[model samples]
Target: MMRVVPLQSSGVRGHDNANVDFVRESFDSEAFGIEIGRIRAAYATSAAGYRLLFKSVLQRARAEHFQQVLRRTRLENLEEVWALEATGFEMMDVVVTFARSVAPAAALPVWPDLRVEEATDETFEVIAHERAAAFFVGIMEDRPAGYVTCVLHDHTGEGEIELVGTLPEFRGRRVATRIIERALPWFAERCRVVTVRTQATNIAAANLYERVGFTLRCTEATFRANVATALRAQP
Candidate 1:
């Protein structure tokens, strides 16, 4: 197989627990700069040639004092999986992206005391720095129960649900679902297709999206290696 696009997000597995701020500074690294995501090469005529390329890249990353390294491939790419395993990389996580068309919907219900509304300056702090995105919060009795962060790409005609979360105490109450339900109309006004991603291991999250009319789009495997440890492994 041959390599293609090399875009990488800041090493997040797309889980709700991941604290990716989506700020440019968080992704910047001065120590080592190469293609950080989706590294692949042509299939090896012999196993030796392919494995050597991975070795060379990992070694260089380590030499540059990078603490950790990551690569992602589609789950169907067995050759890439095996190559990663052979080169001392361990599968960190698998993530699935889901998409749904945003159509006018009958309003979904929320708890009587729980208010699902767009975040205001006082309720959401991130809005101070990020003006283009939208935040919906589940406020029960004036206390924040959960929130969903969304972004619209006008050029692409798409909206991305960047993060979905509910406080630990608020779990199982459908707070997340209600917040997302509230966010949908906001997206519908700006884009037709909305997408969200969550870890494959998160069954509850996967099911939640489906329940909300999202269909599975794609899944990718992320492999991680400690720079020094990978370099020390033999073969």
Candidate 2:
């Protein structure tokens, strides 16, 4: 079973394969690049007995993907830690944090070249309308950058940066920070703390969060991939 929740609020599905095809193709590409080699075994259990198959591609791919992520988001050469007041527990920082790397694996095709768009897009408006705040679309140059879908609840008392992204072509230019800078005022009014959560394996993201005054509340192990000699084995 597969599902996709856009902006984490609504689940969007389609009968046609084209929609899912884009997603599946991206997944296969990412899996092949990072996790394809890790498949060890596959098995299924039933009331009658157990069956094992040597096709743990999904599992292996996940493991390998995460391992690479862990390596990239490593805490190295961290220099400073800054903080911004969003509300109470909600805070923003611009130090060495890793919130930049928590995006879905499908976006990996354009990884590193990504940048955030602070302008409003179609997706941002959908979320902002429900939350009653203005939606902003993050942009990189003339192209449409990543979009952040979020709003302030309870007035300015609670603010959420639901989705922030940096497209593959515009990364490494501090575009996420540009988005953060634009949204701080909304956060400062009501929320005690401004918070963003992402994958722990995303070192760039973690560093970005830290730089923006966010603290590491917790780290969870999610999303795994497999690595095999055929996949990651040295040529």
Candidate 3:
């Protein structure tokens, strides 16, 4: 069993804060220890997003070999680190979803490189099952040019425009907008608020979201490390 550490709460000004918990566990793999902090948003929304603040402990314990196998174990689920204070808060932002019934007058440029079309049976079915999703394909000059998918969260009424990659030749045209237009109604029918989460560092995506009336909600720093590395450093 791992240990749970409770930290003092600083009571951030915005949104309701919750008690935070830290998870400490030992594994049979090369990694000896795994420590991660888990924070739960205080809102009552059905969709929940968890921020993993730290993941270096497994690396410290030299458990790299076992990390993969241990991830599915029950110990990882029950052992969590939680801190109620803002210091422990890693991310903040409420996803936005809009009604499809209302069309945003934003002009949609014709995708220059590709013709617009519906997704195939396989792709459509897969995207429909996602948490936040939109899926569409682009055809250019009688050929399948590109495809994209957006994610939607039913619990939070939020939508995310993900994997909007286009064929290098098909990028200049508005293939992305065409897909977004087709997906808007689908999201509106089922969700109240639709939002697109993209890397703020990507100017093109950020522009697309703003053009479609998506407002910026918030931002958070992310960290990642291998368990094997952490284990070697541990004394």
Provide TM-scores for the models.
0.65, 0.39, 0.51
Q: Please give the CA lDDT of all the candidate structures.
A: 0.68, 0.38, 0.42
What is the C-alpha lDDT profile of model 1 across 75-109, one tens digit per residue? 78676578678888899899999999987667655
Give the Cα-based TM-score of candidate 1 against the true structure: 0.65
Query: All predictions: root-mean-square deviation over Cα?
Result: 9.3, 16.8, 12.2
Off by over 4 Å in 1: 1-53, 103-112, 120-132, 151-158, 189-191
Q: In terms of TM-score, which candidate is strongest? A: 1
By summed lDDT, the worst window of 10 consecutive residues in model 3 runs over 69-78
* Candidate 2 residue 75 C-alpha distance from true site, Å: 21
lDDT of 3 by residue, 43-70 (tens): 2111122122222323222342333211
- Candidate 2 weakest ten by summed lDDT: 80-89
Better of 1 and 3 by lDDT: 1
Alpha-carbon runs more than 4 Å astray in model 2: 1-123, 127-134, 153-157, 220-235
What lDDT is reached at residue 88 by model 1?
84
